[model samples]
Target chain A: MHRTNSLLTELKKNKMLFLMLIPAVLYFIIFSYLPMGGIIVAFKYFEFDKGIFGSPWVGFKNFAFFFQSGQAWLLTKNTILYNLAFIAAGMAVQVGVAILFSELKGRHIKKMMQSSLLLPYFISWVVVGSFVFGIFNYEFGSLNTLLKGWGMSPVDVYGNPSIWFFIIVGFYLWKLVGYGSIVYLAAIMGINPELYESADLDGANIFQKIRHITLPLLKTTIIIMILLQVGGILRGNFDMFYQLVGNNSLLFNQTDVIDTFVFRALNQQGLDLGMPAAVGLYQSAVGFIIIVSLNALIKKINPDYALF
Target chain B: MAKNKIRRIDMLIFTIIGYIVLGCISILCLIPFLLTVSGSFTDDSSLFEYGYRLIPQEFSLEAYKLIFQAPEVIAKAYGVTIVLVFTGTLLGLFFISMTSYVLHRKDFKYRNKFSFFFFFTTLFSGGLVPWYLVMIGLGMKNNYLALLLPHLFSVFHIIIMRTFFTSIPESIGESAKLDGAGDFTIFARLYLPMSIPALSTIGLFIALTYWNDWYPAMLFITNPDMMPLQYHLYKVFNSMQAAQIVAQKTGIPVAQMPAETFKMAMTVIVTGPVILVYPFIQKYFVKGMTVGAVKG
Candidate 1:
């Protein structure tokens, strides 16, 4: 009764503040929280006329169908493996570039490199997709032209599936590595220069200082970055995959991921009922589990790095 | 003496490798853009016959002609994109800052509770179907509201905005309150102006998101007249349906258009303005990203 009295007083005191929160609160309620209940559609036979809740309930049939589709394992494997590659390679390149950025002495040269590197990050995926098309298109691709000019056989970048593993990863790095490096660069800039000076006093070389000091100091940032990435292992970059390898079912074996697969299954197939919703729920469930587990693990190791 | 010499040698090697490797990567990044621009200028026949050359073997304005041939459609898309960016950015920055201000209010005892309430959405979301249904149920289908509302406020933006608000001394708000400003007045008159750096950064980020957005347009919008630039480009590049749609609307022949240079020209048209506008807002974006990275 006493606690309730105090809570009422507090609520009355901050009435304006609470009023300010209504927009955000209502947004979350309508867009986020309400839709959360819609996850139940994943277990239902959704009809346009019947609606989400009005649809008849079905259980795990969508999941079973996805698994039986024979592409389930491939999608799962591709999503996880591709993310792993991105995490590892993205970190190394980002950290390496960050350190390189810090080492460069000429301000003009540094600015130019940084600007050029960041150019790709600002452009839309639609633009990047077109650029990639230019490089990989069969009749007028840059690579094929070069190959032909050099008296070698031209490669079919489109029809081939195997080459896309590199293409997807390369394009991702090309597009995002600059954005990623800013994090490491910020962390690098924040590091005290005195630490490097002391290392130099100890007669440590550039490589040793980087190995012993820079990388060690960056350990937490790197782990946090990787741990952050771990949550999205199940979700694919639909924009990148869609724009780059798009509709080339021939490359599906190499490039098809959960997002693209579900997108096609939903939009293209009109795959009966709520199968796309079911897959989305599956991705979310898996993502939630991984994030929670990772947070708990990180908190145990170092409380500072816990996302929560 | 030997150790000193070895250290000198190492630094020299590192510098050499750094310059070489970084130079190579820079070249690799720049060349494709150059190729595309040159390819855009090449005549239709030469593009397919000779392939994409850094310099056009037979230069032509055929591609430019095709795009300029349909000015009305392109103008409408541009108008839609600009309006989307303007409204979305302003509303997003206002509502987000307003919401974040409350969360960061020094006297607000329920701040943590509300923070989690907002933060929870980022960590967990109901999957796509219900979200789509909620949108459709709300009658967002084919509506401009669908594009504006879904991305208007993000949990991540709220977090960043909240952090920026916290950095402002409580005394600022307190003094404003003493000066007879209401909570809303203090936020609008005092806090918003004082928070220019944060405002610009967040505003630019939101604007860029709107500018680059096609996902919402893809999902919700089907009207060709209402199509934004990015989605329009995606359509043109991805399918013949887009050309057929254009032909249907404009009654122009797409058959005679040069496929190679025409598509490349479209890429330039859609992307060139943003690239030009980017430098002005580059610093703000970098500031926002740094804040998000370090704090988020």
Candidate 2:
């Protein structure tokens, strides 16, 4: 009774301030939490008029179908492998570019490199898709044109699934190297000048200093980033996969991911909703485990960097 | 002295290699779009015969002419995009800033509690289906509200807004309170005007998001009339039906459909404005990066 009385008094005192939060509070409740309630549709057969709650429960039947489908293993494999590759390759490129910039130390060149490199990041994935098509399209494509000039037969990039692994990874690096490198640059900037000065006094060359000083110090940021990425290994970059591959069944073998698989399965035979919800539930459950464990690990390493 | 000489020699070698690598990569980054632009200007027959060329053998405005032939569709998409971006950014800015202001209020006892509530959403989501179903339940299928509502208030944006607000001195709020001003007044009159840089950066961010956004638009909008610019171009590039629609409208398929350059032209038309405005707003992206870079 006393707690209730104080709470009411506090609410009354801060009525206006609280009122300002009403829109945001309402927005989140309606959009996020209300939808979260609908996740139960994964276990239920949802009907349009029956809605999420009134739908009949089907136990793990949805999950059975998902696991039974050959696509489940493939998508899971693709999602995890692609994410790992992207992280490893992306981190390497970012670190390399950052170190290069840190070493080069030319104001004008740095600015030019940065602005040009960042251009791809700013452009839409749709435009990037067009760039891919422009280069790789069999009829009048730039790659084919170059192959002709080099007196070699043009490779059918579209028909081949294996080539896209490189194409996708290549574009990923090209787009993200500049943006991702900023963190390393900031980290590099934060490094103690005295350590570098001392190394310089000891006659350490650029490579020697970087290997000894920069790489050693960057290990933490790199690990933290890797750890953070490990938590998201189950998730895929839906935008990259969706735009690049786009219903091309030929490329599905190489490029199909959990998110895209879920999307396609939902719409495959005209809005079969439960199976997709099952997939989402599976993703979220696995993701939750990964995240919790990673957070625990990070806390053990350094609580300061723990996400929680 | 020997070490100094070695260091100088290393720098000299690095300088040459660095420029070559960086310059070549820079050109590679820029060249694809340049090729696309060049391809868009080339005539259809010549494009088929010779593939893409740096300079078109037979220069043509046929693609642009065909695009402008269905002027209404193109214009409608641009209008939808502009209106969506404009309204969404303002509404999002107002609510996010308001919520942020409340969160940053030192006197607000439950600010951390509220902050966690917002932050928790970032940790997990119900994923695409349930969210999609909810929008459907709300009758947002084929509705413009679907476009605005989903993109409106991200937790990331709110947190960034809070960080910006907290950076402002508390004395300002205290002084405003002493002047017999309300919390709303202090936020609207005092902090809002003071937060132009934050507002602009966030506003540009929101605008860019709405501009580049095709995902929600793809899901919610099935009606051709409701398509935004990005989705509009995406549809054109993805399927032949779109080209048929344009050709059907213009009666211009007699010239081999011009599908190749038609897609390229659509890309230009949709993304041209963003390209033009990019350099100006690009710095603003980097400015806010370090502070709020950890996006969920």
Candidate 3:
């Protein structure tokens, strides 16, 4: 009774704060929590007329269909492999750019370079898709045009499955390297100038200072960023894949990820909600396990870094 | 003296290599945009003949003319996008800041609980199907609210805002409370004014998200009139029929149309504003990203 009375008094005292939180709380409940309840659709054979709860359960048949189709392994492999490639390549390029940016001598030139580098990050994927088409379209693409002009046979980039791995990773890095570098740049900026000065006093060169001091300090930030990325390793970037390789069946073997698979399954003529939802649940369950385990690990090592 | 000379040479070599690498990357970043611009201006026949180039072999304004002639579709898209961007950014910023303010309150008893409430959503989600069903169930199909609502309150933005709020000294809010200012009043009259940088940073992020958004529109909007700019451009890119339809409506010969150049032209037109305004607002993005990373 006393605990309930104190809780009521606390609520009364901070009523305005609670009031301010209502919209956000309601947003999450409607958008996030409610959908969580709808995850059961994975096990159901859904009909539009029947609605989510009214749909008849199918008992893992959706997962059976997915695995039977062989897309389950393909998409899972593609998603994880692509993400691992992106994470590794992105770190190297971004950290390199940040370090080089620090070494840059001229302010105006640095600003201009930074602006140009960041230009791609601002535009929509649709625009990037057009750029890809302009450059890689078999007949009219700039690359083919140049090849034909040079007395060489034109390359059919889109028809080829093997090259798209490079194309997707290239565009991903192109769009993000500038944006990603900023975090590292900020970390570099945050480092004590005194450390660098002392290194200089010891007759250390720029490379030596970077190797001994800058890199060691940057290790934590890099690890945290990588850990954060690893937590979402199952979640493919739907926009990037969809925009770049839209329904290109030839490239599907190399390019298809969990996101695009789910998207196609959901949007295809006859909605098989069960299979797609099953795939989605698979992604979510694995993703959730990864994140929870990672958080637990981080909390054990340093609570400050734990996402929870 | 010999060691000093070697050190100077090493520094020079490093600087030279840095310039070359950074310069090459910058050029790689810029050349595609240059090709798009050049292709937009290139005559139809020449574009087909020569492909996209750094400079147009034969300059023509036909693509731009065709678009502007029956400008209603493009203009409507722009209008839809502008409204979504402005309204979404304002409302999202207000709600995000308000929530952040409450969460940042040292005196608030449930701040940690509330913080966890927002943060927990990031860890796991019900995935796309359920979320799509919820959106459909809410009658968001073909509705502008679909675009506005889903994006209005990102947990990432909330975290960034809360971190910004925490940076302000607690004594200010405490003294304001002592002066008989209520929480809302203090948030509105004091904290809001003080957090312009945070507000603008988050506002710009929200605005950019809305402006570049096509996924929501692609999912929810089947109505042609309701399509936002990016989705409209997407449609133009995917279907030659869209360009042909526009050309036919304008009484231009479909055979004479620059469908290839038209796509590039549309890309330029859609992306022009962002490129133009990027230089001015990019620093805030950098600041927001850096701050978010530091404590996120």
Candidate 4:
């Protein structure tokens, strides 16, 4: 009772702070938490009038149908593989660029490169899709144009499903390399120059210094980024994939990931609602578990680095 | 002598690797932009016959002329985008900063709970499908509100605002309280004035979100008149048939039209304003990202 009183007293003392937080608090309750109550829609038919709570409980029916459709394994495979490739490739390119940027001593070239690299980050995927279509269009695409100019037969890239993985990966790299490198570069910049000065005094060359000093310091940032990425490993880059592939059923075999698959499944048929809700629920749940576990592991390894 | 020899070698190797890496990064960004720029000016039949080229075989402005002739559609899109971006940025920055000011008050007992209220949303969202359903339930579908409201405020922005607020000297607030200034007055006069960097960063973020967003417009808007610039541009760019048909209907010469280059020109058009403001925005955003790197 006394403990409760002290807590109440403390709360009252900070009443203004509590007042300040009320709007955000109300926002989340209405938008975020209130909607969590509707996850029951994943299990229900979700009649608009009847709403989530009063809707008929359909049990595991939605999940069963989704699994039975045989898209589950394919989408899961595609999502995981694509994300893994993105993370792996993106990290390598970004880190390499960051390392080079930090090492390079020229002022004008560095400034120019920084500005130029960041330009792609500003472009929308809509424009990016147009760029892709322009380059890959069967009749008039740049790749084909170049090939024909060389007296070689132009490849029909759009019709070829096999080419999509490389094309998609290439497009993703083009859009994100500069943006991702900025973060790594920020991390590199934050590293104490005194450390480098000490290395210089110790007669260590630049390459040796980077190997011994810079890479080691970058490990924490890299690890944190990778772990954070692991949480969303199931969440594909929906915008990129959607824009790049569109509804081209041919490339669905190679390109369709869980998010896109769920979108199509919802929109294609009479709004099943339940199927996408179930998949979305599944994604959130897995994501939550992965993130929580990753946080826990981080806490165990290094408490300071743990996200929460 | 050994150290001097090693220094020269190190600089040589560093310069070589640096130039190569920088060159590749620049090329990666530059090539697509070049393709878009060149393709926009290239003749349509030529494009249809040969494909997009870095160099135009028969350069023409027919595509530009068609767009300029019927500029009403693009102009409306631009107007809508500008309004949405301005309104959304101001309102979002206000709410986020206000909310963060309260949360950062260490004396507030409910700060932790309220922080959790906001923070928990980030961990487990109802996901896109249900949220879409909820929006539909609320009858925001096809409404401009659908585009503006859902993303009016983000949890990420709130946290950054809170961090900035927490860095403020608490004595100012205590002194303000002593002066009988209301909490709102203190916030507006004292806190808001001091946190321009935080405000600018959050404001730019909100503005960018509004400017770049086609997701909400795509989901809800089907009316051609109501479509935002990015989404309108998206629809035209995606369907070659759509662009060709529009070109034909507008009485553009099929032979002279630079359909590909026109697309590039539109891209350059849409992205032009943001690029002009980018260097300033980028500096703040880079700073914000590092400070907000508190979260993964």
Best by TM-score: 3
What is the per-residue lDDT of model 2 for residues A181-252, given as tens digits with 9 covering 90 to 100? 888888888899999999999998877888999999999889998998999998888888888888999989
Which scores greater on TM-score, model 2 or model 4? 2
Question: How close to the true structure is residue B212 of candidate 2, measured as C-alpha lDDT?
Answer: 88
Candidate 1: tens digits of C-alpha lDDT, residues B191-225: 89988888888888888889998988888898888
Mind giving the per-residue lDDT tens digits that candidate 3 earns over B52-71? 77888899998898898889
Candidate 2 chain A: worst-modelled 10 consecutive residues by lDDT = A264-273
Give per-residue CA lDDT, model 4, range B1-296, as digits (tens): 88879988988988987898788779768787787777667666666665677877778675677778777767888998999998889888888889888878776666777777788888898777777777787787679888888777798888778878888889998899999987888999999999987788778778887888888887888777677888878877765644655566677664555555677678767876877888767777767766777652
List per-prediction Cα lDDT, in the order shown: 0.85, 0.86, 0.90, 0.80
What TM-score applies to chain A of candidate 2? 0.96
The 10 consecutive residues of candidate 4 chain B with the worst lDDT sum are B239-248
Q: What residue runs in model 2 are displaced by over 4 Å at the alpha carbon?
A: A269-271, B294-296
User: Candidate 2 clashing pairs?
Assistant: none
Q: Which clashing pairs does model 3 show?
A: none
How is the predicted docking of candidate 2 categorized under the CAPRI scheme? medium
Question: What residue runs in model 4 are displaced by over 4 Å at the alpha carbon?
Answer: A1-22, A46-55, B239-262, B294-296
Q: What is the C-alpha lDDT profile of model 2 across B1-296, one tens digit per residue?
A: 89999999887887778777777778878888788888899898788778887777789998998888789889989999999999999999999999999998888978888988887776677888888887887899899999999889988788888878888999998998898999999999999999998888889888988998898888889898899999988999887767777878888774577888888888888778988988888888788676565432
Those runs of model 3 whose alpha carbons end farther than 4 Å from true positions after fitting are: A1-4
